[model samples]
Target chain A: MKENYYQPEIECASVETLKALQDERLVKQVKHVYENVPYYRDLMDKKGVKPEDIKSTADLHKLPFITKADLRDAYPYGLLAKPLDECVRIQSTSGTTGRRVVAFYTQHDVDLWEDCCARAIMAVGGTKEDVCQVSYGYGLFTGGPGLNGGSHKVGCLTLPMSSGNTERQLQFMTDLGATILCCTPSYAAYLGESLHEKGYTPETIPLKAGIFGAEPWTEEMRRDIEKSLGIKAYDIYGLTEISGPGVSFECSEQSGMHINEDHFIAEIINPETGEVLPEGEVGELVFTSLTKEAFPLLRYRTRDLCVLKREKCSCGRTLIKMSKPLGRSDDMMIIRGVNVFPSQIEAVLLNEGYTPNYRIEVDRVNNTDTFDVYVELSPEMFSDTVREITDRENKLAAAMRTMLGIGPKMHLVAPKTIARSEGKAVRVVDKRKLH
Target chain B: MSVKQISVFIENQPGKLAEATRYIAGHGINLRAMSIADTKDFGILRVICDDPEQSAEVLREGGYITNVTEVLAVGINDAPGSLATILEIIAKAGVSVEYTYAFLGTRMEGAFMIFRVDDNAKAAAALEAAGIKTVEQSDMF
Candidate 1:
């Protein structure tokens, strides 16, 4: 069967054709970076490699990997491909460590981004008739505008509702007969809570599909969100540096997110050794934008670690599918010489009937790493006595020990006592210096 | 004849009530009488104090959400049927007492009871017309 959606020349393009397209684009991007971005030029010169040496996509391995620190070094606007006036739109990522990293996009870049988004929407069986309610934030963030423009490209009735104001979001979802919703998975969970509070059920909102991403979510959360909202939740993945939230998407099969390989090449490489790993092997994900115009990336190492599967999907797209990112390299906490991800703690907390609000404090006591978890009890569990609380905390400690190989001291705090962020939740606080 | 009353919304927890009372006491607000109406989720802490304004402000600022309401502080005789007489008058006037608790007055001749009803103004007026003295904010403080 001939796939109408797949571009014949690109999707089924021969290796020679693919390499030619990549080479042309790669050379242009390299020259652009060398002329405009001093960071990339200096890094390339230090590695004793010239842009011409990267003649094929496979030769991309010769290029130095660009890390988040490189982006930080460049800071705002230091990596732009075009002049400031030519750039039409910009999006920034919330830098947990310092100032936000801003990405620039020309009109052409925006069109390509929207096309990628439209493809993502189509992957999940969304059509022009579907009403897309975009609940992702619009200002300074790539999520809202990226999905909004893409939904528009797909000829859907787009609602750029943005985030928060749950009452109004529900009102518009019901009033406007919205069918597709987009937002962070956590916000989706909160929306489910709001719907229950207002005595509304799955039948209340005309939602049939959801594209959730921006933050790490587990399969358990996906199930909860799907069951609560009565919608098929598909994971969409992207970063502002690459082109925002339409870089890849999960189809109706829910197998994995299919990367748009024609535009962006996805590679899994061993994070420690920087060696490319074979398909199905878990490693850090790296991408080289083959079609991006405004700020084409060359081997940008997204610290997100995941595996890729090249088997043909039931969705008939020849693109590569990536398993959900486990966690960022920087997000992994070394407690007592054992690596622990906050997501693991979160999963344990969710199953333990504790509220998701939590804080992890790491200190050095007696010259050893002492991990203390401050968990907020749910409203139902607030009345538990000190004995009961201690028992539950001990149970959590045991579970953490079994799961993470390092037991942390548990501190039960009152509900809503932990600080809440309007953006990403800060998970780790290292206080070894105080010791 | 008058007594101060304060209403507070307290989430049902082990130490919330103690914490609220401690906060009020720390602010120098003398507790006159208190009662509570509780469900599984939350409880209403109804308190009569010597300084209603100060008590309410302290509780509110301390994050113990509370409201101040006027209630009749009738000097009921320290004997049986005195409480029944006041309640009967309220029931006859079509007012339902949601909750009530008593505290001994400075003297043994009377007791001050704090009542929480649906209609505070109507209950106060009806009790006053029945020859009962309703407390003002200044009278108790």
Candidate 2:
């Protein structure tokens, strides 16, 4: 019956105190970005704004919104606020066919990001005695490093099983008795299904809680994953662009994820007009990295569509809660914890001497994203032997994996099998009910 | 001598084999001998047909991935040791049999064995040198 929190004062602070903290941090962050990041400084200067123009969070709306386009334009080094020597690491976005946005982090930034994640793990019942297994894809991907560092900070025996090799995941989970699981919802679901298929019930499995995120998942999926694994499924949200998977997290109540408002400030804006929306009003989620040294973004638009609620929580954390992202304003789809764009697929097809006509079918099978890309086959590409055809398909899949980071099932079908669109082509068919 | 054998690439889903068979039958191509080697994702449907070229052409027109493989059709005598003798000769000749199946030869024989061997010409030469008659395409068609 011990009420637990990693950093009680910060996590359970009053809304007034949190607001004051955000305001103080926001003031310092604006000056930091303006001084160190020429890219952001130019952006602010273009809007005829200065560091002294911002006083508090109320003046946050005066700043120009930073979009993904800006991130792309800035590319690898334009937005880097600190010097390379001062920066400890850089995590690049999994985006294809363009210059990837690289988010830089100093050691201090890493510590804060991990601290945010530690609060998340603790909220989900992580303790010093617990063995936390982090199954997120490690390196370049934020899901693994963020949670793994947090687990270490929480004094849990960190199991850095960086995704895939499900057999080993199970072996270590049962043999080592991993008490907490950290990974995407889809992967967690897959693990649960795998364990059950191996005839291990919830009671036999030692895992008590799971923190799943990076991709959107539904409540039904949560319950299904929870039931299968016999663990409470908590959602954690973050983007590599915003220091990755520790920005917000869910507690025991699981109503919604609490945004770690101390390090990062959350805002919602009408995407089309760039006007701030009131609380409870659903819109595009924006973030401002307050304490980050190497990368401090000011009012950075997330492109994710979700609403924020400041109502009282049963978990007793006063952090502002963001509902699960309703959907994205853009065509970006998160499949198996990877950001996939139709343009990336199109780029692959066009580059590989294929027709633009293709169908991308995405579905949740056993809580894992099943991605199938059916490319319309030209007559010349047609073959009679399964061996030759499968070889060709595998080669295409390998190319896609190189481009997408995650491999897709390549199915070369008849030339006219894919339905031709009249007005516009509907390329991606995402069947996951994450909204 | 080697005869043409048709192999179709098919996904491992229920009714796919049926559909492929029906399509072949509808095109008036007779399946003389058939064998399906299945993997987790798909199945390779191989068949000795009355018209291998026509079957392949029709299947390709139907948008099915198909390929033609050359295999030997050896006529086995009506004796227990006859088939064993042919296998022993081929095994000694250093030619590997990838796969094999049987069908009644339309033109002749007690039993005709379709041998999908690594070296069909070599196996055929060994069979011929051993005094075993290998059926030609006309015999199966």
Tens-place lDDT digits, model 1, residues B14-98: 8988887777778888776677766554566777766678767776677654566656666677777888988888888888875
lDDT of 2 by residue, A172-267 (tens): 999999999998888888899899899999999889999999888888998898899999989999998889988999988899999999988899
Give me candidate 2's interface root-mean-square deviation: 3.5
- Provide DockQ values for all models, in the order shown: 0.03, 0.25
- Candidate 1 residue A94 Cα shift, in angstroms, is 1.3
In angstroms, the error of model 1 at A415 is: 22
- Which has the greatest DockQ? 2
DockQ of 2: 0.25
RMSD of each: 12.9, 4.0
**Fnat of candidate 2, please?**
0.30
As a whole number from 0 to 100, the lDDT of residue A315 in candidate 1 is 64
Whole-model alpha-carbon lDDT for candidate 2: 0.87
